[model samples]
Target: MQGGTTIVLPEHRGHRLGLALKVAHHQALLARFPDVEWIATATADVNAHMNAVNDRLGIRVVERCIELTRPVGRAS
Candidate 1:
């Protein structure tokens, strides 16, 4: 299962709410899908807080993705 973005509003920052939510979601996923093998999720490279939360949950970076864009009518 792929995880969606987890956000805590600015007013609720620094209370570890993101971490707690992720933990709860993971537990529920496991309970509901015992046959599942892996869960995939992504966060921006600069999202240090989310990265830390993922680390705590034993989620390691398997790969990195980069996106590039150019003008629609531009020629290479």
Candidate 2:
């Protein structure tokens, strides 16, 4: 499972480039690796745009991960 990164230039957003790129990338990778059974990618939960695209592609939420952050000078 590898390679499904989609990035749209800021100036090129609003044209569905991200969705198109992801679908195309997935198709190409699958074609080149027919033996693969699972492919994985991660995105922040709040990113509705990408999440929606992922959902449309039959990807599902299998796990939830939380990242904790603190300022350098702040005590935990």
Candidate 3:
């Protein structure tokens, strides 16, 4: 099982709803599947807030993907 997504309405954003959702999700997953060793999650580079929350939840970056974009006709 995985965290589908967490989207808090603008008015609800600052209340740590995303963090709460994720932590609760982790707890529920562990309860239902205690033998599971890892739960995978991801966030974009610009999303510092969610990253902070994930860090608080003991999630670490085991790997990262960097996306590079350039004009179709441009090259080094």
Candidate 4:
């Protein structure tokens, strides 16, 4: 499992390395573990660039998960 931060790097702008790496890693994992059924990843819904690459790679948005947090013991 891996998670990435923002995509505001000037050196990486206009390059698809992030997408390429993600795809390559996914393929490698699949090849290394043929028995595995699925490989998963996540990115912000607003990240259209990542979404486009994911679409190209045939990744579908299966479920939407949201994180809810509250102060420990501070009930609503």
- Where does model 3 exceed 4 Å of error? 67-76
Sorted on TM-score, best first, the list reads 1, 3, 2, 4
Instruction: List ranges where model 4 is wrong by over 4 Å.
Output: 1-8, 70-76
lDDT of 1: 0.89
Q: Mind sharing the TM-score for model 3?
A: 0.78
Instruction: Provide the TM-score for each candidate, comma-separated.
Output: 0.81, 0.78, 0.78, 0.66
Q: What is the lDDT of residue 1 in candidate 3?
A: 62
RMSD to native, candidate 2: 2.8
User: What clash pairs does model 2 have?
Assistant: none
Q: Is candidate 1 or candidate 4 better by lDDT?
A: 1
Q: Write the per-residue lDDT of candidate 4 for residues 1-76, one digit (tens) a residue.
A: 4545535366776688767777777777778778877657787799888888788888899999997887766575
Q: Write the per-residue lDDT of candidate 1 for residues 2-74, one digit (tens) a residue.
A: 6678989989978999999999998899998988898889888999999999999999999999978886665
**In candidate 2, how many Å is residue 44 off?**
0.4
Query: Candidate 3, residues 2-72: lDDT per residue as tens digits?
Result: 46777778788978898898888888998999999987888897898889898898989998998888766
Two-way lDDT contest, 2 vs 3, winner: 3
Candidate 3 accuracy as lDDT: 0.84
C-alpha lDDT (0 to 100) for residue 69 of candidate 3: 84
List the candidate 1 regions with Cα displacement exceeding 4 Å.
Answer: 70-76
Each candidate: RMSD: 2.9, 2.8, 3.9, 3.7
In terms of TM-score, the best-performing candidate is 1
